[model samples]
Target: MNTVKINWPNKKSSNCSPGVDWLKAAYDADIEIPTGCLGGSCGACEIEVNGEVVRACIATVPDKKELNVEFFSDPYW
Candidate 1:
């Protein structure tokens, strides 16, 4: 399986499979990414991945050279 390096906002990094669940991978790396709905219906689980805003609940890790991910916070979530 192919793997990609994910860099978190906390300055922590982890090597994960491209098909892995983003939320689970983040959690395994000791990073807590807040979530609301597990599905893609709600926008509360949105996150920034490689400069793109993606819904974590419905998005999977991608195969990339490296992934820089940051949590997307909404004042009114």
Candidate 2:
């Protein structure tokens, strides 16, 4: 199972399991990212995955996709 480790800006480590979805897993882990709706339609929970800005609520956890789940806390740019 391919896994991607997420390093939060606060230096927290999170794992995105092969079967476990990233967004859901993060939320379940109580890592707490912003989310207006769980349904990925609002695009509120945007994140910068590997330096590329993406809507986390809609984006799927790609295999080996390294994500820095920090932008969730600093949503300015």
Best by TM-score: 1
Which parts of model 1 are misplaced by more than 4 Å?
Answer: 75-77
> Judged by lDDT against the true structure, how good is candidate 1?
0.86
C-alpha lDDT (0 to 100) for residue 44 of candidate 2? 76
Model 2 misplaced regions, further than 4 Å: 18-20, 39-41, 72-77
Candidate 1 is scored at a TM of: 0.88
Instruction: For model 2, name the residue pairs that clash.
Output: none
C-alpha TM-scores of all predictions: 0.88, 0.69
The best candidate in terms of lDDT: 1
The per-model lDDT (C-alpha) reads 0.86, 0.68
For candidate 2, the clash count comes to 0
Give the range of the ten consecutive residues with the poorest summed lDDT in model 1: 68-77
Listed per model in order, the count of residue pairs whose N, CA or C atoms clash below 3 Å is: 0, 0
Cα deviation of 39, candidate 2, in Å: 4.1
